[model samples]
Target: MNPNKPSKYLTLVTEESRVEGKKNTERNPKNLRKHLSSIRLSRKLQSGIDTDFYEKITKKFLDDFYPKKCNNPSCEERILDKEISTRPDIIRCSKCHRQQSRLSYTPLMGLKLPLYMFGVVFHESFLQFPKVITATEISKRLGIEYKSALKLKRRFQLFCSDHLPKYKVLTYRALEEEYKGFKLNPDTETDVAPKMGLKPYVSADACVLYSASQRANKGRSRYRYGGLTSSIFLSPKLGGKQVGTLVHGICIQNGPAFFESVSDTKANTIGPLLVEQIPYSVPLFTDSGYPWLYNIYKNHRSVNHSAKSSEARYKLARNRFCKLSVHNQVIEGSFRLLKSSFSSYCYIKPEYSKLYLDEFSFIKTSKFFGLDCITERCFGSQFSWEGRSTGAREATVVRIGQEKYPHRRSSKETKKWLIQAIKDRKYQEPEREERLRRNKEQNKYDLNSAEAISRSRKALAGEMKRFNDFWSDSQKSKHKRKREIKYENLSFKIWNSIQYYKESSEENPTVQFIADKFKLDKRTLMIILRKWLKYGLIQKRKLFNKESHDKRVDFSIVLKSDSLPHLLYTQLPKNKKIFRRMDQ
Candidate 1:
């Protein structure tokens, strides 16, 4: 049935219905495509106006992805053309006689466009548009109205957001399908990623993004949440698809951890934040900003650079050989580059930081995998959106210039600019005298300084051992502090034990718990408790109304460790009187 034709239920398109016909097969009864020869196919392919080809693609997509059986909630019957009496393309279920269109139960069920057109639009949406292809390109490629093309692009982008997370699994499936049955040649490029790309030790750093909603022409400036902070971990020498590619993990949290509330990134809050991300088995390479990492993990390396000037820190990092032997240079450089990209995304909401971080993560991972600047596999459909207000792409339009493609300029452009600069007598370029001197010095070592280089390497290795010793020695003070608390008096231990007893609702604290805490025998603790109770300083209640059972103490009488000792010393009599009272 033509959607434009007059319907029994409501008014729509002005076209009238033709004679209703019965169908008997799945493919079209007219064989509308048998006449399309090879020459005509080639011409239509060039002309970009082939209804028959698009229809074939649409039909194939529907058969593969959509439910062909009855879509009615109560029915479970196969739909065949013979059952469809009115519409040839639409079928009725054999059991319920309910009409079932190809778009039934899908988001496109009530759409006015032909199934083929919508199929192309959806395919483009998921695979091509917004990033790879624009609305203008889509309209030109599909040979559709500009309005229709723009609308389709928007609708498809929204749909992709709904199914965005599935793209990862789908991308993996696609890779497998593309390489299925091919022998593994063990090439260095592909083998490198698996072997060297999986790094355990990684450098960590964070950069903030100031992005905002771009819906209005000029949106509000202040968001309740602060700017987005992206904490990135980079492993440059990790196993990758290529020999030298890097892999990374990221977190968006504790934004603007300075001058903020308790939840911000302080030592106490940062420990829990980073400990959960890094596994215990992996060593952490960080700066002293994360001091708690030393306590939280078994293996970690941090260099104290906060006291040093920025230039001094840079010089220290550039040395390549250091006493600490731990550097965050890789992640530090990444943060610097990432900060430059934040200019285009200056108004980001703090809560949506993770989503924004994922965009960068995908781009970097794509480079690692040698995926040519495509974002097809960045998102997966398995995850749920945080809320309804999100998912509208924050960056609908971004200006890509020299900032994005800094190295894309050709030699001609460089020479042109240089010649122009010289003619204008503007010496803006840096003097290469120091750089040439370093290169000359390095080349001499490259030629015959092997013995000197080896000696220097050994000396540096020895320095690393010294660094480790210093690091280990620093932990002794921390250990001493821990021991001081562990040796507190029995009264203090009892007060701590009583706190546990008061907090628990079910299993009451046992007599043995207090004894174990203070390293005292259970009998001695009981004797002390019995003496206290006899002196009218404390009281005990019968368990389950049984006089022969366990006893419960009145926690209020001995409130704190300081007060308990004062009461005992002031009210109790001398030891000779205590002994006489005990004997009696």
Candidate 2:
């Protein structure tokens, strides 16, 4: 090699490593050591990781986890300052002249790594990139040890399970007015499923839950399997790779939906999801396996479960969905898509089953929801699954403390850590207010303290109102003077986008996809697209007459009675989806 030429492994080695040269020895292996020491990987990672961003996030997480005033009743400190120590981030109590380990009181405590590196690990784990990543692969890319990467990976999995959101009920009234019209009750008894209630263009189903780790254990019983009942929706109006399904509530791509570990196909396990999630007004094109026409949902028994007719009696109660055009194709496709979404190791252990489910949920929804949103949602959570007084952190911290005690080289590290961490935690023990907040989060929007839910809904409603107001205002003028131009413009934008999606290998981009792309209202955009693409909406002008007003007619109302399905799907006041009265 030339004297001035850089080494081929220069990218992999750090400045210090280069200076040390081969004579100093590479950090390849030290099999005799019980645990491998962190090498130049930390420095390399630090250089790559955005320290400032991670620091801010760490501070935010710490503030949310730990309390102010040293958490010590006797301490006079009002505010804590974050400083770097052996633990990376510790809150120093000015008055007590003591410090509290930031991550020590949370799930992220222990498993030595810098806060910035931890942040990087978290940031990368939640990311939907390369579509195939393992701890080994991550270790190589992040320049960290495989074990550390694996630990981080496991922590993320646990984190996902622990902090999975208790989603707000997607009520009928809460749905956008546009989608509300399409949401139909599938109950055949109450005349709910109209002759023409069709919303989903196509749908798929996936109902199996298995893991590699779980299967590897021979003693693992078949009964231990988790039942993942999922539905994937392809929006009718949106063409070209536009699909949304119920994950939690709305399908924001890799969205987390109603998930449970139950095996039996009973109403109790599936009712809440069907009623709250499924577009009840919209015809669900499910397969023959789930021909559940009507289910007397828990907390929603107003619709007489006495059976609509012989057909209704034969269907829902019997689990007989025979002889239907709809198949489990969409969900089946989704399931296949899901399995392939992961790399080689597709199995998960039974212990972290729910967490694994939650992970898949977010992964699937990531396409629509965006990785940033998923990451924020995953991290901001308090990991409430364990049901502790202060939510997940309390239990997680305790577990971590116990786990780390054995990992320490001697009593010195453990004792020093315990003094600061345990003392701070004990001082800041959850009070009545903290407990109440936990309860609120755990139970979600209950009857008595519906305030939180109401507030959230109000916030969402305000956002929707603002969005609608802006579009509505624009339409108010365009509805009359430039309706045709509006139609043409929207048509061009929608169809052009569809073509673009197809050209980009998204063969069937949904109208929702287009609408989402343009930030236009789905209802409004779909309506225009229908007129232009399907209903022959054209603005005819007199030959060479610049001043002549084009002759065009609004064809939106014509479809209101065109067909039974059209009538059912129409926007008429009478056709509007009716919501069940609020529970007393």
Candidate 3:
């Protein structure tokens, strides 16, 4: 019926088919092309997981872990030319006949997985820098157990951590100067010292990771069984208890970045760290919060984000474009990246924060160096497994051989020889015993002699005489009495008396007057005054005795203004007995 004149049903069906085809062709070309390419890419990648891929991985494993030279020191011939057997785990040196296992000393030692699976894991985890692949993902993708994938991933992380290069900007001389409280010695030869000019800028800042609040029971207690028992409900009050880890991060302009977990961001903690990590000559950019940065570094500049005045804001903006422009945005961006990386983990314990930071630093450093350089480093000899010595191997062989034999010795001839050696020792033993007996008798005869007794008595008398000369009873008692007195308390009292004299009278207090006032021993008072003068807490001035009309020198104690705060804040004992003897 539809052959000649198209039926309504047929026309409707044709129109519907045409519309569906048009809709399919009209789909977003960009998304359609991307979807098709991804499918092909995935298939190609999956196809690569074949025998050739395994062989390539095995070859690489052999190249990295195989011994390069004969272990024998005398015969260190290059073993690279030697052909690896089917079981490439162990290789033998052609010249020296020495054998070594490929995995002996490497992080891959004791690996139970196939080399291909391990290679896959390595390719996914290490090759993909800045892109994280969790163990669960690896397990799902590679069809391996989660525990195995995790172990492999952790091994790679540890390897990277151990072999990561520690970059230090400051030289040994600079570090020494910083350690010595930044005191410049005039005698130091500056002409020979290398000049570090126009050093690159380094920016430093800190960020908190895994910040979360703990929950507490906020509900009221309810009675159970007619008030016989009570139960407290936990309502989980969020934001009541907060916890986070403080991490200090630093990054050089167009260079690698570093991170460290710190307990605090105070000057005392971060100041020395900055000096150690960044050179003093280099310009440092930081926030206005760290006011002490100016005191620490000579070329330090801080940006005040909260500046209200237009002039101040304009100045900051101008500084950003000027010759010595300063900004810490590099470190700020690095912290943002770091926090993003940490976001992948559900929770990071405080103790392991350093390890995670090390990983982050390694990733940043690898980015700077590129993936090829990182691959070479990971395969370098530094990360190789250390093999056991030949002597140790021989000892193990001997132990196994002895275990195999019932009598320890292999044959009756060895047993007979051992028995003969033992008999020879037995024959010598008697003669040795006889010689010992004769020596003992001679010693007893010597002890019983009158000369021996007199010699012993003379030795004892000499020791007693020396002991008395070195440490007499009177000297011991004097030292003990002096040690019992609190020198700190005595010094404070003397300082107080000097202050009173300075404020109340025109003349300063003399040592003899203070000694008489405190009833302190003249010798002890001199010792305390010497310490005060040495520490610059007090100044000593020589005055002429006008009353005697003679050129006799008398010293007076004058407290220094610089040390007044130290004296004022110095803690003193609460007990009055400490100052009783000095007061008397």
Candidate 4:
């Protein structure tokens, strides 16, 4: 129905019903496309218009408004005439139905140009604009006038495409009609996500969008900006495609969220973050870019592709590798398609590069999959920071694997350790213990009265030195001060509390995390750990016992009876000789 047409219920009647509402309204049914047709006709009627120009404009108009089905109001036909009905807004047979594509009502609706022109522009941008050929060259290839090409470029710039997120979670009820052979009915039940009440370990990776690095203005070219799109994919065990959610995703500059763009996304990030927000422990999977991302989770696992492989390449590529290795296929495929299909998009203006990439990310996700999947896949769909708020918790259904998980140990063991530490009274350091002790010894320094406690710069420096000294040996103190509280205790505490921040997982601690977590001399601690590992402890499996090999070294033999028995002596090395024994 035309919104512009007179309303049957309202009083303001403009065009006076060509035929009364109940009286032969079918004679001239409402055709909203008449406006677009009028626009086309007006363009055709204009003087000085060339035949090529008319055909081009006419084609564009038709393509833009074409329908896949008969949109005519009077046509009550059930069976569709695909060929005739699929025509553009132009009439077919006596029916004269308006045509529409599935995308006509979407963000693509406002576009005024044809799809061929748009598709061509889209493909060209992926190759990176301002490279092999100029926009003029593109105009020649598309057979569009230079002005028309420029107009199409502007429209593409303004036209919004859809973006689909690589990661998506779907419940049994919600995941209907998505896959080819899969069915989500009552009888077709499968083990869903967060299996064993554990949190789902999702791996997130990002691909850089090269096409978004276009120069804004006409004259100069700058390609400083690009889009970093991140995806979080669920593992196969948890119902694979059947049960999953694209929990988070975002497009941003190259930063921590991207893990420096080495290769794969870190599942550690996805696991811990998901666990915190949702309920349960999540064993995450990821690439070597974030070797420790899995450790951040309360319960997690990982496979580093950067390591060497001893097996055959073909065998490794097959079922075993797929099952063992957590590959981000969806994210990887998205990158491949973006690069192949839209290479020309790279020629966007530098200023709009960021904006275009951001929108482009959304467009791609939405186009392939619907908005629902996109929402579940991209974390930053509604929020930012790669879809996670700085302080937001993960879902409970996820669990982050830890080196020394607290749940793995008995409660009695944990309690015993804490009690022993308290009994030893070795918790935090005493700040003013020395001053108080000295005051107690002197009668002139009244406990109630405030003495002249002005600190000298030199004294302050000395105090600082002592503090540094104490901090330097904190690891030792942490170990020896209480036999019950040793390295395992330390590892346990760290494993439990570190969460998904960069600190808890990396082999080397970030300065900030170290400085804040334990007031220790980080430099000294690092040095000590490194030196001890190299020099102190031998490999546990090595077998070498000097004492065991020479058991007779500790025993002295004194012959009692025979003279020959008394003639025993040790053999010396090289020129050194034993005492010459002669029997009488």
Q: Find the candidate with the highest TM-score and give its number.
A: 3
Q: Which TM-score value belongs to model 3?
A: 0.45
Provide the TM-score for each candidate, comma-separated. Answer: 0.31, 0.41, 0.45, 0.28
- lDDT of each structure? 0.38, 0.39, 0.50, 0.32
- Stretches off by above 4 angstroms in model 1 are 1-47, 71-97, 124-131, 143-147, 165-316, 319-584
**lDDT digits (tens) for residues 446-494 of candidate 2:** 1113342243335333433332333334334544424533453344434
Badly placed stretches (over 4 Å) of model 4 are 1-202, 207-284, 291-301, 309-325, 344-360, 371-584
Candidate 3 shows a clash count of 3
For residues 11-60, write the lDDT of model 4, one tens digit per residue: 33224442243244345456535544544554333422233333444344
Ranking by lDDT: 3, 2, 1, 4
RMSD for each model, in Å, please? 26.0, 21.3, 23.5, 26.2
What is the Å distance of residue 352 in model 3 from its true position?
3.0
lDDT, candidate 1, residue 305? 59
Question: Which tens-of-lDDT digit does each residue in 1-584 have in candidate 1?
Answer: 43222232232222221111112222465533432343344433453334544555665544443436666777744543333434435756666777767654333444456556756654443442113334566678666688877555444433332332333333333323433342211111123223222232245544333322322213333333342211111111221011111123222111101111111233433444354444543445566555444323424455565443348535444433222345566566566555555444434433333333444444333322222212321222221212213321321211112212111112343324423322332112212453234322311101213342344335333433432333334344666534422332233345434644554433444455556556677554655565445534344543342465755432232322212221121122336354232223
User: Least lDDT summed over 10 consecutive residues: which range in candidate 3?
Assistant: 396-405
Residue-by-residue lDDT tens digits, candidate 3, 376-462: 223221111112222111211100111111111213344244233223222111233443344233211101233423443453334
Top candidate on lDDT is 3
